[model samples]
Target chain A: MIDTQSSSGSKLVWVFFLLLFFAHQDFWLWSDDSLVLGFLPMGLAYHALFSVACSCLWAFACFRSWPEKLEQWADEAVDPDDNRSAS
Target chain B: MSDFTFLASAGEPVSRTPLYVLLVYMGLLLALGVLSSRFFRGTSKDYFVASQSIGSFMLLMSVFGTTMTGFALVGSSGKAFSQGIGTYGLMASWSGLIHSAVFFAIGIKLWSFGKKYGYVTQIQFFRDRFDSKQLGYLLFPILVLLIIPYLLVGLISVMKVVQPITSGMFPDTFALPDKVLPNGKSIPHPLSGGVPGWLSGLVVSTVVLFYVFFGGVRSAVWANTFQTVVFMITGIVAFYMIADKLGGVASAADVVKNHAPEKLIREGSIGDWHFFSYLLIPLSVGMFPHLFQHWLTAKNAKSFRLTVIAHPICIAIVWVPCILIGIWAAGLYAAGDLRIPPLPGGGPNANAALATMVRTLVENPLLSGLLMSGILAAIMSSLDSQFVCLGTMFTNDVVVAAMGKDKYSDRQLIFLSRAFIVGIVLVSYFMALYLQGSSVFSLGVWCFSGFAALFPLVFAAVYWKRASLGGAVGCILATLFSWCYFFYQDIFLDAGAGHGEYLVQGVMPVTFVFLASSAGMILGSLLTEPPSRETLKKFFPTLS
Candidate 1:
């Protein structure tokens, strides 16, 4: 996450990756575990695996983009004058 | 003739081209034109809402088509097939109720706002409420992202069913049709590939889009009336057919209870968590931009409420046929009385099983044609509105606003909207090409969750005195964050690939995110102080 010196707020983009990581880990569990009520279609099972894999990559993208979103949010919140002379 | 010849002859007589069916479809369209003539006028208001002159009866029928589509017809029936009577128990029924309740609670507020401001589209409300064109601009892209996939799925499914029925009209020479199957009953062998499926999808799409392009929402409403009738009649026919096959309702219920008890009884057999998670789906329906757009189109508060009251009964009736048949289908397939062909690899096409059920019950060529039309009607009724809304969002909110500076005239904007509809259809078609995951039901749920997250903010914006702009922004972003997380985990990570694991086990993490967002909105607005009394009074002049 990008550092916003003014308020030190965490960027919103990080949330996406965090969710994605968990989702992927969940898929792996679904695949390896024995579902007690596993009456689902085999196609559903296959697609579940596919969704998990795709999410992992999206999470990576979110991680990389966090700094940018943070910078943008900070820029929106603060005026340039406060930092101009200080810098 | 020998016994073999007799059997062969029987099969041959049962199959016939879908010629008269195409003519019937055309006649239905012409009738729609005549019925809608007096209702149609030149202005946008006339097109969008019939000048808010619609009565409760018409409003009720049209709204039915607004939400029910191929998914409900195909997917819900499939669920009933596998799950039994219990699927319609508390879980599904409550979700349906929540959807209605949210509409009444949130919908009345929206309709009131629309009445106050004469709002036309989803973007119009966001733009005015936030006091920022920027918010409308921001939302336009998101609406497109959500709506187009929905339109593509509806159109493709409709075409998939309608194609064989209309093949006789188009003929092999006209559309480069191939004779892969000896008749429509058998699946086509590996094509010495002929005209692409997309080509057929495009042809059907163009026809639906034409009315929406020329007539806009008015066309959608009129067409919806016919489509809704078709949906209900066919649904009833389907239910009766299935019920009869099962030895009437009482005997059929007994067979289902004994043979497919798991499905017949809704005793949390599917697991408590799974049943509960399903709640978010119908709840999300009222919040979808297109659905709300319909709400705003209502003539008065009384009509709106009456329409809401009628929908559940209509839906309950429509759902019965699909569910009962699904139950019967599971039993038949399991007992070796029926065979459901598997997809190329090994899995069942549970989605197509409903269509297969229809193909089984009706032997007459004409009746089969009518059944096919009912399915297509279900699909197209939903698709048209989706396209109209999708294209309108892209043109009105995104392209025109982004271009800025007296960018286009009203006529130009309307034309642009139509072009975007076609563009959206193409993009969604491509996406469908890549999709091999999730049944229509599951996919529909996933889509609903995202929009459901947005409902509360809008509700507060209209009704709460202290709903500050700051609160709206915060709520919107928070909901967005929670939605992305839930879908990412539920779909891609948990359902798609072996990449991530769920952090919070059930729908709670997602639900909590929404709750937190709502709380933030309430607190944020309360702390910030209300907008200037003058600003409020100007926007809401009726407030004494």
Candidate 2:
């Protein structure tokens, strides 16, 4: 697991997420109905691409901040008698 | 009710295509329910959350399916039909990001706590966190109230779906008369003869309840995986077939450009604040009681990797086709290829827009039946999960917790959950019949807003050590009050039906509700005593 204490990657992942959120507010293309590749509306096409970019950044977030500590705690604190679903 | 015999009298040959497709679809799910039950571990935990052993692929499918309900498929298209192409950008893109974000930030932590504490439902977590059973009891009714509308949504969508897709599938049988609204206008029955609403509704409700009752969470997961795949394929195939029927995707776009250019743009229909507020709707997934239960089913923390990474892409795949299909419907109306949409006092039955387009474009009965089954897949995927989750909450949070866990055997606990599931389904089924032919998709949004409004309670519970029991209660009451107040204004004071849009300062009610909830959370925490150190230490490891 990546170090949560000083991981710039964690911060960057969130920064990218914030950027994506802001980019999602596409006021510039609000009135523009022009098609991308002669099919997708410019707004719809932009958001479609935005969705892809979100996938990439979230993948990074997962790899960077996978919450190893939280999982570790759960593992350590798990009830000994749990035998829950045989994890 | 009068049977038109319109199509059959006009010499349209009747086929049993939709009947067969529906039977196969319903039968498949029932069989799955039986199959899953056979392997059941015969314990409460295993029944409720699949013993928390679901792996990555299963988690992805079940989570995606449970989240992508009738709203994503039916409501988005219907909303897109009414508003514009901006509908996709309005909700889908935000969902792609925000939903996964919530899943990452919120779901994993809850799963950790669940695994550690042997908690099964969200209420257990809240009760433990705030050290207040009162808070848990209060949140329970509110969540139940919010979830009921969604059940109505699934039921109403089926009521809408069956008639249109199966309009000419019979020889002047089961045809309904135009439903007379309180307003002067009426919705002409789709055809003279077709499948009856009660029969279809009963079949769907029975199928979903059967599976959930037998296999509980595991059955819901197994079915959701199958249904998610089915609907995704449905979207693409429907897009291809409808586009090809209209020439091509480009040609369809050209048709819209030439005829209903307004639908292609956002300015005339959607404003920036209005568009931005739609993001709040996606946040409801963060608070969905059903989705919380699904998260607990993950085999491990790492099982979420596929879900978080691939969710946005999955949303894009389903939503794009549904939204595009809607805009193309506008093109159909513009070119006079389709009739003027029948407007109730509020708006056209946008719910029918997608189904109507399918029938108008596709000629083959077999193909139409298959496509319609895909819509059923989308609806029932969430329905089964919601049914089981309410049961889980009743068993773990309400009954078992109050009665003392040691008092009841595992079999009795499972039985209580199953009994509750049947009750809710029956209640929702009756509600569906009571509110037939109403604007279901719009009411579904209100439910989303209600859930979205309470999201901060869960957020602060997870993130903030200073959060008090009072704060959690205050946050929930604020959500309830603000929601009820706005709902009152939008429905009674403002006149519910005609305009059909509910907004405060050009933004959805959800925006104001969310802000109000956050404010309540902060103020209540400040005014009241801080949570105990032991409680904080349990959740926030850094404090320890």
TM-score for each model: 0.74, 0.94
Please state the CAPRI-style docking class of candidate 2. acceptable
The candidates score, on chain A by TM-score, as follows 0.32, 0.78
Q: Write the per-residue lDDT of candidate 2 for residues B23-108, one digit (tens) a residue.
A: 88888888999999997899998998899999999899999998888788878888887887888877789989999999988988
DockQ, candidate 2, vs. native dimer: 0.42
lDDT of 2 at B90: 76
Of candidate 2 chain B, the 10-residue stretch with the lowest lDDT total is B1-10
lDDT of residue B182 for candidate 1: 29
Clashes of each: 28, 1
- Could you say which candidate leads in TM-score? 2
